[model samples]
Target: MTRIHCLVAAVLMSLSLNLQAEGADLYPLSSPAEQERFQALTEELRCPKCQNQNIADSDAPIAKDMREEVHRMLQQGASNEQVVDALVARFGEFVRYKPQLEPRTVLLWATPVIVVIVGLLVITLVVVRSRRNTETSSALTPEQRRRAEQILKDAEAP
Candidate 1:
């Protein structure tokens, strides 16, 4: 009985997993160029509801509506930039998977590069400082070495 229950649960879980994939819309377009544009736009735009997913891959209602809007705009002969701009205006820049390079997003875009540069500089400074300290400390005079050895010998004496 337990084995039967496990099997039923596994089947149901698999069906639920596929439900999202099955929910994708099939929009019609006029030409291959338009079809390519539609595909590109849908795949490029992120779903507001599914933060990590694009509209083409997400099953969210908002994603479906966005996809429909993209299709309608394309059919109305809107340029790709116009369609994207309209969506961005409606949903804010969060809808764009790749944000435009502007003053507001400059810090976000530059953070990784800034971090890497700082890390490299820190490593270089540490290495150079360590080498300099080693060089200075290792330059012990012969007299100092003899005195240090005598001190060690005296310490080890009875």
Candidate 2:
């Protein structure tokens, strides 16, 4: 009974492994160059459904469809730019992992710099105000100077 159970488990494991191998086959490319390009594009493109994940890393249905579309376009002899343009037209700049520098995206690219500049301005204002306060408090009017000198003299006499 033990030998029979071991034989059955071995057969089941072999069958599962074969199925996985079949499923893992990549779409055929015309050449090694095309395969490299396909990989680069997939890694660079973001999945519309999985906003934070690139298509190569995402398992979302939209990502799967996008992968299929890219494979189809590459097989049909589409240039890298052409394939990217098609996707950007159908979906939007949001589908790109690195968006281009454009008027519409200026704010997105500049926000960090703008924030740093604003923070520096605030710190300068605070420092200047503090110094002004310190100087004003340290300076004495004529009457205040006389009063302080008199108090010091009285203390010395006692």
Top lDDT model:
1
Distance from true location, Cα of 153 in model 1, Å: 8.6
CA lDDT scores, all candidates in order: 0.92, 0.89
Tens-place lDDT digits, model 2, residues 23-73:
445667888898888888888899998868898889898888888899999
Residue-level lDDT for 142 in candidate 2:
100
| Model 2 weakest lDDT span, ten residues long | 19-28
Pairs that clash in candidate 1: none
Lowest summed lDDT window (length 10), candidate 1: 19-28
Number of clashes recorded per candidate? 0, 0
Q: Which ranges of candidate 2 are over 4 A from the true structure?
A: 1-24, 146-158
TM-score each candidate: 0.75, 0.76
Residue range 57-156, candidate 1, lDDT tens digits: 8879999899999999999999999999999999999998889999999998999999999999999999999999999999889999999999999999
